[model samples]
Target: MRTQVRVVSRWIGDEQGVTSIEYALLAAMFSVAVLGSVVTLKGSLGDAYEAVATAVTLAVTTAMALVS
Candidate 1:
């Protein structure tokens, strides 16, 4: 009976699964951060491109008017 109790106690004290669970949680957090940044940066880059496109169009129209 004592040996059985010791075996059960040892089993309860083992921590092999804890590290794996912690690493999994950390990976999930990193994935979320990376995904969120890519989405936000994509939006910002699109806005910047639109602004540059508008400026270029205006400049070209003005140049054509001056030439005419």
Candidate 2:
């Protein structure tokens, strides 16, 4: 029918929803980037904590040896 054809054409040409769709895509991309950064930093942070812990243990043992 002509009415249905016109409706479909109008829907296809409509720009009202474009901004919303673009924003949704932008948000999705930002979330992915943040998640990736967090995952990468997780490993680095663990390594740093381990290094600090080892340093503290060494310092404590040295102090104890000097005291004794």
Candidate 3:
């Protein structure tokens, strides 16, 4: 019974495993934040690209008309 108690106490005192777990949790949280940002910005980025494409198409059409 004393040996079992000692082992448990020693395990509880050891912090290496705890530190690793904390780092893993931190990384997971950072990954979640990055993924959320990307998802939220996806629609905005798509809309901006579409707007730029439309403007370029219009400019090209206007230039071609002037040339003709």
Q: Each model's TM-score?
A: 0.57, 0.50, 0.58
How badly does each model clash, as a count of residue pairs? Answer: 0, 0, 0
Candidates sorted by TM-score, descending order? 3, 1, 2
- Give lDDT tens digits, candidate 3, residues 38-63: 99999999999999999999999999
Most accurate candidate by lDDT: 3
The positional error of residue 20 in candidate 3, measured at the CA in angstroms, is 0.6
Q: List the residue pairs that clash in candidate 1.
A: none
Which candidate has the highest TM-score of all? 3
Better of 1 and 3 by lDDT: 3
Candidate order, lDDT descending: 3, 2, 1
Model 3 TM-score on a 0 to 1 scale: 0.58
Per-residue lDDT of candidate 1, residues 1-68 (tens digit) = 99999999999998888888999999999999999998989989899999999999999999999999
Stretches of candidate 1 exceeding 4 Å from the true structure? 46-68
lDDT of 2 by residue, 25-52 (tens): 9999999999999998998999999999
State which candidate, 1 or 2, has the greater TM-score. Answer: 1
RMSD of each: 5.3, 4.8, 3.5
